[model samples]
Target: MEVPVMFTLQQFVDAPPSEVVRAFTEPEPFAAWFVAEGFRTPADRVRIDVRPGGQIAAVFVGDAEVPFTLHFGALDLPHHVELRFDDPAEEITVNLTELPDGRTQLDYRSVGLTDEQQAPIKPGVATMLTHLAAYFS
Candidate 1:
């Protein structure tokens, strides 16, 4: 059993919450910054319904293609999102708030992760933030 590991990441981007949130909700922006080192999302990626009860779909790269399914659970408009990654027994909740200077503050908290399981991804958040910085720049 994986023990819950409470982890939080905060990022301040040079864009309004609305635009940053839109980039997250849109498929093109998602695939570009969401890619981890070991995973690959297709170029033809398209996000289906992003509202509650919608499915986030993607196909892995190469011949050994594996499909992905993430379900949008709760959505609080241009502020928060709750979802679950189908292949993993995990839940995801992301929150965003607009700063006074047109900057967006993204905060994420994650649980249910084993040390070994999260070891590799410990650096992934930083990698992702770097991409987000470039993206919002």
Candidate 2:
């Protein structure tokens, strides 16, 4: 049996689509904003290989150093990015659109989760996107 769980979240950032893409693709900006409140590390601690088959290795240091890898399935700069994580096997898609006011609208979707899983992940993604917006402000 499989649990059908998915979530879609939209957020508007006060920056261009290009800048939003850079935040997700580039290592330094990614490290800065892709963290939770108490789980941030220095930019140098993150490694991102921005390509279709590339990988992102992030180190989250709290009580201990926890490392994880996300593999990119597709990458279309300033437009879309699709990635998958191994441990629990989750797939995520990010789509960006430029609005007239020079801001970017982000559409984030994640699939392959249980109801128990979606509860926490949904809010976490929202918070991360909020941080992303703060990075540009």
Candidate 3:
């Protein structure tokens, strides 16, 4: 079997790593920042179980309501998280690093993507990260 290409993106947030982690792990902050222009999930609809083998599920309200689930592979508080999803059969790793100036550097990498799959999701991922940055601002 051929290995799929990996897509990676990095962003710097003007907040501490702990705060950044909360944005990713906590329901309210996750819903706040995980939305794009066309996709929005209310905080009440976001359910997160932050542990290895746990899951995060949300119902996105856009032109249509859609449900999404992410299975956790690993969870290291304030530093690292690994998630897997079935629709694309992808593995995503999120790494957080703290800068000396007190900002958090977010490194996001997703593996098991084909060119066709990556093309469309790339822009959405970028948009979500931009929203995340704005949430901190």
Per-model tally of clashing residue pairs: 0, 0, 0
Query: Model 1, range 72-135, lDDT digits (tens) per residue?
Result: 8889868898777654455677788988888888887666666776677658866876677568
Global lDDT of each candidate: 0.73, 0.85, 0.88
Rank the candidate models, highest lDDT first: 3, 2, 1
Better of 1 and 2 by TM-score: 2
lDDT of candidate 3 at residue 115, scale 0 to 100: 81
Q: For each candidate, what TM-score against the reference?
A: 0.85, 0.94, 0.94
As for TM-score, the candidate ahead, 2 or 3, is 3
Q: What is the alpha-carbon lDDT for the whole of candidate 2?
A: 0.85
Backbone clashes counted, model 1: 0
Q: Please tell me which predicted candidate would have the highest TM-score against the true structure.
A: 3
lDDT of 3 by residue, 41-137 (tens): 8999999999899999998899999999999998888999999989988899999999999998999999988888888887888888887877886
Instruction: Indicate whether candidate 2 or candidate 3 has the larger lDDT.
Output: 3
Worst 10 residues of 1 by lDDT: 83-92
Error of 1 at 108 (Å): 1.1
What 10-residue stretch in candidate 2 is worst by lDDT?
33-42
